[model samples]
Target: MAGNRAWILKSRPEGLPDMSNFELRDIGAEPLEDGWIRVENKWLSVDPYMRGRMNDVKSYVPPFALGEPMQGGAVGKVVESRSPHFEVGETVFHMLGWRESAAGPASAFNKLPQMPVEDHQWLGNLGLTGATAYFGLLRVAEAKEGDIVFVSAAAGAVGSAVVQIAKAKGMTVIGSAGGADKCAWVRELGADAAIDYKDGPVVKSLLAAAPKGIDVYFDNVGGDHLDAAFAAARQNARFAICGMIENYNAGPPPAFRYIMRVIAARIMMKGFIYTDYMAEMGDFYRDMGGWVASGAVTGRETIHEGIETAPDAFLGLFKGENMGKMLVRL
Candidate 1:
């Protein structure tokens, strides 16, 4: 039997994770059990959420066990199938990521539909990334037409989607990115204004971008961004607190000097996970799928080739190295 090479967590990371915490090991491939399917992974998703999983603390999702193959989202082609539902050569999406291949029961995978977009996109724009933006902005934030919306980490996978989706809904969108190039990309995605956060204090820039005050804030990078949103939000404003990438590496949480604004402004703030809105996934797919197919809601990806580069791809998220979605093409 051929050996399957997989990335395993050697130890839990204290702050920023490095190569020393991971080890690639070769394990002998075993015969498929009943109702199992063997899949050759073609693409792997490296997301910010996976950073939380590397820690030992309890979270919405269980921490990645030491010595086990780390997992995320992956799209693969089934080469062998013992189940009637899955067939040889069929493509499917599953959570068995961070490896070159996986063998699991057919129930663990969802078959991909025939679409004009590439199969890898099923892990990105047309998939969880897009869904996160859709539900976070529309459902959680309750954004409406003519509302002023601010999105932190605006050029990232989920933030970029929020920028475009808010635009599609006729909202005035303000985006914040770390550099000039990412800021430009956010503007190109139809943001009314894109703030280069590296240039100055985000609160000042957000105030300048939306002097009238923001109605909805889609927060991807929390900390300073959350403080700025609180200061710039209008009365009865809504905040959808998504991932807080700024504090992912383990550091002092950002002190909010303007927290009083949350009360004075009567702001509604809610932290949400995408899975919380799983019941509305069908609506998300229908709407986001149409917008993607029509080119109204666009998405970009930073592809890192080879499974060996997966760790680098994930680490790059902290450096703001990716403009949009980051994926490893296996």
Candidate 2:
């Protein structure tokens, strides 16, 4: 039997997530139980949404339990299998915990087709992050041709996707990132303009970038970003309220003042979770997969080379240290 390491959540975090909240342990492999398989983890995602999971309060996704293995999206290769649906040598994606290995029923994981060694991995641009951008922008924001699309956190995983998708739809895109490097990267992703939110007044900058006024705002970072989006919206503009990475660290949820703009601009603001539209997965895949294959759209990954460094990679998202999808390679 082999022993594998796992990182578990020991306590709920206060403000920013610290290394003290996690503890490492070793689990020895045992005989497979019925309907279950053992997987060797290959890649794991470190996303901003994971911050919300540490709290005890209920959210769109359930909170992580103390003393339990901290769970998130992971891709792994099956080393052993007892389930008929999976077999040895197959790779799968699941809500497996942060671990070198996992054993779970076939129903717990979605099997992925094996790809060439150089092919795009399923953890980033080709996976959920891409799907979130495709549906959240096209479906929720209802982007139209010639629309001025503004996206916050434009250098991050989902934000990057929003920029490319908007450009492909024949809409002018403007993005906001934390620093100059990210601003340049957002422009490389096809945004007509990129604003450094850290430079000055965010709303004022966005307004200047899109003097015609923004028709669609695909918001990933909330708080001040949302307020700014509201202020820059055109009459009858649509705002898609996605993840709020900005306030994820704060102890209490942040408040925003936007009633006046909501009424005056007649802005349509709506929040969406990916699961709510699982029925649309087929459409999303058809469009995104084609775009990815043809090089019409692309994704970038900021990979942390090993499992031990996963915590730092996860913490970096809050600090804007990553320029694309953050992944930990095992």
Candidate 3:
């Protein structure tokens, strides 16, 4: 029997994770079992949410067990199948990531739909990241035509999608990113204004960009970004709180000096996870899929080659190393 290589959690990270927290080892593959399929992972997604799962605390998703392979999103090809639902050579998307291969029940994998986009995109655009942007902006934030929408981390996967979608919907878009290049990319994505947050205070930059105030905020990076959103929100504005990458690593929460603006402005702020709108995924695919095909929405990826570099890819998320989705190709 051949061996499989997998990354196992060596220890729980205290603050920022390091290579020391992970261990890669070779283990023998189990014999094929009935009602199961074995898949060779081709691409794995490394996202900000995975940082929360690293903690040894209870949350929406269970924590990764010590000395075990951590789970994530992966796109793979089935090599062996004992289940009628899947066949050899078929491509599938599953949650058993961070390893070279996975063998599990057919129900654990979703057959990928044939699309013009690349297969790895199933882990990003047209997948979780895209869905998060669609639901957060259109549904949760209740963004509408002529609304001025501000998105933090505007060069990231979810935030980039939000900017493009808002533009397509006849909304005025204001985006904030860390560097001049990222800000330019935001503008190229159809943002009415792009603020380089590295220049100065985010609140000042946002206020300057949208002097009339903003009607919607798609928050991907919290901290000063959240405080800036509150300060820039117009009366009766809507805020869709998505991932808070700013505070993902263990640190003291940002002191929000503008929180009182939420009350005074009567802003409606709500936090959401994409799974909460799974019932509406079909709608998202129908809309976002068309936009992507028509070039109205652009999807980008930063791929880290080889499974051995997965730890660096995941760590890169905190360093603003990726402009879009961060992925590891096995």
Candidate 4:
């Protein structure tokens, strides 16, 4: 009588998504096909990028179909395997999420290697969020030691990782968060200063935090934060355009007032996806793994229990409800 519990896209959200847009359904067991495996997801990722997939629009990834189970990032166990590539009890990271269980071709999953970290850590510091921070700061932004780096959403998942990694690499980091507590946490992550964006205008606070101007900017919240970065950028500053959580639910707003500064400051801003570095996975694992083991970096998480709570966790990303990576423990 056991069935897989899943959250389906009942309808496309108009402005801000609500519970009405999601429906919990039961996916009954199905016969396994050759070269396929059945996985029971343990940890599900709730990210800002998933918001774009809710709308029926052209993007880096396809939109979630109506009345179908949604997908994001998930790490699970192989409960049943009909493929040589995967074995029963093996841990795997896959794209099939927003559900308790899924049966798919073995090629759809990556068999996780034996690691000293927790199983969920593969979904956090060693996962997409961590990789995003790593590539964005080091590769995209070309951040180096002695650089003054500014990161928005510094207490959130990717931003927090950028703060820690930048500090560990000997760069002076300034982080901005929405609240006093979140700002304090950013400071604890080794940022030279933490700007509380809610306290006043981000530009004013950022200018005060780094009077000399920042050599690099890692952006998460785009609207005012991007404006602040442009105003506070040093000559030839580099920017890694990460997520724009502000405009995710809201339609694209007008360009930043300081948009013209890109030419004035000779800034180089680039947007990138983590998958673009698939060839460097080994390099990422080695460096990030050592940093994690040496305590030079840490992964923080805010978890919601059960598959039914997944929608709420996803919804919480825009509301600033999570300190680090928001995850659902199924």
lDDT of 2 by residue, 13-65 (tens): 99898999988777556578999999888898888889989999988889988
What TM-score would each prediction reach against the true structure? 0.98, 0.95, 0.97, 0.98
As for model 3, its CA RMSD to the true structure in angstroms is 1.1
Q: What is candidate 4's lDDT per residue for 1-330, written digit by digit as tens?
A: 299888999999988899999999997776899999999899999999999999999999999999999998999999999999888899999999999998998899999878888888888889999999999999899999999999999999999999999998999999999899999999998999999989999999999999999999998989999999999999999999988999998878657888899999999999998988888888889889989999999978999999989989999999999999999998
User: Which of the two, 3 or 4, has more lDDT?
Assistant: 4
Rank order (by TM-score, best first): 4, 1, 3, 2
Ten-residue region with minimum lDDT total, candidate 3: 25-34
- Model 3, C-alpha of 103: deviation from truth (Å): 1.0
lDDT of each: 0.92, 0.84, 0.91, 0.92
Residue pair clashes in candidate 2: none
Candidate 4 achieves a global lDDT of 0.92
| Span of ten consecutive residues with least summed lDDT in model 4 | 250-259
For model 1, residues 205-268, the per-residue Cα lDDT tens digits are 9999899999999989889999999999999999999989999997878679899998889999
Cα TM-score of candidate 3: 0.97
The digit string of per-residue lDDT tens for model 3 on 10-93 reads 998988999999999885586788999999999999889999988989998999999889899999999999999998999999
